[model samples]
Structure formats: C-alpha cells, structure tokens
Target: MTKRIAAGAPPGLHRALSIVEETAEGSKLWCAAAAVMACTGGRRGRAAAAAGLASVATAQLISNGVCKQLVKRRRPPKEWIPHDEVEDRPDSSSFPSGHTAAALAFTVAITPTWPLAGALCALPAAVVAVERVQSGAHYPSDVTAGAAIGLTGAWLTRHAPRLILRHWL
Candidate 1:
C-alpha cells in the first residue's frame, strides 16, 4: 500500500514537506494569535477558539478511534524513514495523520475570525504532512484525508449551534 502511494506522488514532495517543516515563525504567530483570540472577549474570537478546539477533538476521536482501527495500516519502519526535526515519533497507525488533521481543524475554526490564523495553520499543517513522509508514517493521501476530516469537523462545529437552534426552536 505504501509502495503504491509513493509511486504516484508528485516529484519533490518530500523536499516541499521539509521546507514546510523547517519554518517555525508561522507557528509562533499562530500561538500568539490563538492566545489573543482566547483573551479578546470578542464574540468571533471566542467562537473561533471554541469551534477550533471542539472540531479538533471530534476529528481526533473519529480518526484515532474509528478510522485507524478500521484501516489498520502500518507506519514505515524507523529504519526506512528519514531523520527530521519534529519533536516526536507518533505511535498511532499511519493511515490518517492526526497532526495534519488538527492543524487543518485549527485553520477551519479560526479562519472566519482571523484570516492569518488559517494561513498560519497551513505552515504547521504542511510540516505535519511532511513529517509524516519524513517519519515514514503515512502516504500523501492519508495526510490529505486527515486534513479533510479536520476541515469538515471545523466547519461542522462552527455551524452546529445554529443548526441545532433551528431544529430545536
């Protein structure tokens, strides 16, 4: 399965992933921005934080619990994967990437309030995607699926209250 995916990827994707991972200024910006959003008391800011956190949590639950067990794919052995600067080697199955999912979820949740937040999330998300490759944990498609799940989760969280209200009232 890994061989099949690797064969189809565009050229130099690994290099692109490395470039994305090496940049940290963007992530710092996100952390500071997320802090500001948490503290601002603005309705939009609060909503971003709430939706972002909730979406990420929900996405994680679905991916790690349901999808992983269902897919049951193995990660590339440490021997075959390249060395990288990422902080940790994830223990989970590699079919859907959790980091990429969370980063995309953050973007989805925060973009409405802070445009930069979404772009900034992309930096780390890109890193996570690359790290998966570098760490030999996932194929590009798996990371892509994880990101889609997160984005969908974020979108759902943002609109859920209104949907519920309409249904209930």
Candidate 2:
C-alpha cells in the first residue's frame, strides 16, 4: 500500500501532503488551531479549545512517549517510498503515528463541545492520518493504532474527571 501510494500519487498531491505532514510535526498545526479558537471564539470556543488541547497532549504522551517506547517497529523501508520526505522520518518506533494520534484526539475532543469547529478539524485530521502512511512514516496499521489511541485519549479527556469523582466520592 505504501509503495503503491508513493509511486502512484502525483507530484502536486505529494507536495501538498508533504506540506501538511510538515505542518503537523510536534502537533504544531493543532496547537495553532487551539490558539486561534481560544483567541477568537467565545466561551464555547474556549472550552472546545481547552478540551482539544488536553486531548492532543494526552494522545501525544501515550502515542509518542509510552507506546513508542514499548514498541520497536521500524518505519516503512526507504525503498518503498519514492520521495525525499521519506528520508526525513524520525528514527523512533513507528508502531503508532504520533501525528495521527494528536490530530484525531483534538478532533474528537472538540466535536461534542463544538460541532462546526470539529467538522472543520476533521479534514486536516484525516489528511494527517493519510500523510503518515503516504509519507512512509508509518504503515496503515500504525495509523490505525494511533487513531484508536487518539479516540481513547479523547474519551479519557471528556469523561475521566467525572469518572474519577464518581469513583472517589
């Protein structure tokens, strides 16, 4: 699949994906979005932004700090990718894509609080997922695992406080 995408995708799409993927590094894009929401959006937007940022942070910790530490999977082979961007992939374990995890975490966390903004975020989240595989930074399974982690992170961010209070009280 990675090979097919690397070879078949047009130069224009490759450039676009590259830009998107680059912007996503270290969750920079999501952070920027959160800042925008917090600054320009009213009360609801601030709440949504807070939720989204929390989820992103949780997802990053789980995906990059914990999961990647436990898993030692290598990235897709360079030979499988046809682009120079493949060379720029990190040496860290590729069993889960941190970018995808962060992207989905933010999107999912914001949805219940702000549907319109969540819908807008969904596109870039999807792009980040695809770019993980298309850029040879991860296999599809890695992205899938990352997505699951992201959803779990969002769920935790949304309900953990209530759950903890319920358990303790």
Candidate 3:
C-alpha cells in the first residue's frame, strides 16, 4: 500500500515534501509556528503560542516515548523511495509518524486561540501528513495513528489544566 503511494507521487513534489518533512525532525516546524506567534505578541498570540508549543511537546513525547516504543514498526522499504529521499528518512519506529504528530498537534492547539491562524497553519500540517507517506518514511496507518495521537494530545493540552485545577479544588 505504501509502495503504491510512493510510486505514484509526482517527482516535483517529492523534493518539496522532503524539505517540509524536516519540520518533523527535532520539531523545528512547531518552533517556527511558535516564533511566528511570538512575533504577533498579544493576548491571543500568546495563548496560541502557548497552546501550540505545549501540544507539540506533549504529542512528541507520547508518540516517541510511548507509541513508537510500544509498536516497534519499521519504516517503509528504502527501495520503494526515490534516491533523494532515502537519506532524509527517519530511522525510528514507523507505526506513528512523529512529524505528523507535531504538525497536527500544533494546528489543532492553535485553532481555539486563533482560528484564522490555525486554519492557515493547517496547509503545512496536511502536507506533512501526506508527505510522511509519499516520501516513504511512513505508511498510511502510521500517519493516521500519529494524527490521532496529535489530535488527542491537543485536546488534552487544552483541557488538562482545568481538570487539574478542578481536582485540586
């Protein structure tokens, strides 16, 4: 299934997606989002930045520490990928895409605080999710799992503080 998807991607998009896929590595994309939010600096901007940062961090930890460790899935076959993409691909477990997790988490978390920004942010998030599969780094299932984790993480980040305070009180 993954091989078919990889074989079908446009040659032009492969390079761009690989470049954008870098956002997944070290959570640089999320950092960029936060930086953009920081520059906007006001009540809404701060809230958006804080939520995006928190979502990305927590989703990354859960995906890398818990989900990947538990699944231990291998990446898609290198042969199925274009020559340029092999080196850029990840070596970690493949059941859940860390890149997609961070991308979606950032987008989902930002939506409530800044709906327009979040809507704009989703363009790249959607790209990275598909790119994870198209680049031969992850399967569709992996991207799906990562997205689920990201969405759940975003929800948790938004609501956890209230829940925590409620329990304490």
Candidate 4:
C-alpha cells in the first residue's frame, strides 16, 4: 500500500521531495528554528530558541526512545523505494517518525513566541512529514503518531517553566 502510494507520485516531484528529505536530516530543522529565533535578538529570541530546542528534544525522546522502542515496526523495505533514495535510510525501528517529530516540535514551540517564523516553518514541516512516508522511512500512522508527540512536547516545553515557577512562588 505504502509502496504504491509513494511510487504514484509525479516523477518530476521525486527529486524535489528527495532533496527536502535529505536537507531535513539530523538537527537541521531544529537548528534552523534556533537560528531564526536568534536572529530576532533580545530575550524573546533566546526564549523562543530555548523552547524550540527543548520541545524538539522531548519529542525526539518520545518518538525515538519511547514509541519506537514499544512499536518495533520495520521500515518499508528498501526494495519498495526508489534505488536512489534508499541508501541514506536509518537502521532504527520505524514507528513514529523522528524527523517529523522534530520538525513539528520546533515549529509548534516557536509559534507562541514567533508567529511568523512558525508560519514559515509549516511548509518544511509538512514536507518532512510527507517525505518520511514517501521515502519508505515511515507509515502514515507512524507520521501521525510523531506529530502527536511533537505537539505534546511543544505543549510541555511551553508550559513547564510556568508550572515549575508556581512551586517556588
């Protein structure tokens, strides 16, 4: 099902999607959020960066450490993907997508403080989510679960500081 869905994509779009997928690797999306925040300068900049980074970390833990550990599902087989796109895939269990999780985490966490930046990130985040499935790195359900974790992590990061401060005051 997933293989067919991915294979049906327009031939012209494959290269663009592959490029987006590659550029989103590792901490690039999260770091981009941080750089945007920092460029704004002052305390707001620092707070946004801190929140985005913290949320991404939490989401990564939930997606990779918790959900992936519990699910233990294999990625769509390499043969199911385009020959050119399979080489860079990860060896980890594929359930919730860590890439989408981090993309959403940074996007969501930054929204409260920097709405414009959040808006800009929405495109890349969406692309990353789609690419995870298209690249055979995740299933649709895996991407959905990852998005949930990202939102939860962003909520926690945004509110936890206030929750802690209440204990002191």
| Number of the predicted model whose lDDT against the real structure is largest | 2
Candidate 2: the clashing residue pairs are none
Candidate 4, residue 113: lDDT: 86
Runs in model 4 deviating more than 4 A are 167-169
lDDT of 4 at 18: 78
Question: What order do candidates take by TM-score, descending?
Answer: 2, 3, 4, 1
Pick the TM-score winner: 2
Candidate 2 structure quality by residue, lDDT tens digits, 6-119: 677788988888898888888899989989888888998899999999999999999988999999998999999988888798999998999999999999999999899999
lDDT for each residue of candidate 4 in 87-115, tens digit (9 for 90 to 100): 67788888889988898999999888878
Residue pairs in collision within model 4: none
Candidate 2 versus the native: TM-score? 0.98
lDDT of 3: 0.87
TM-score for each predicted model, relative to the true structure: 0.71, 0.98, 0.94, 0.89
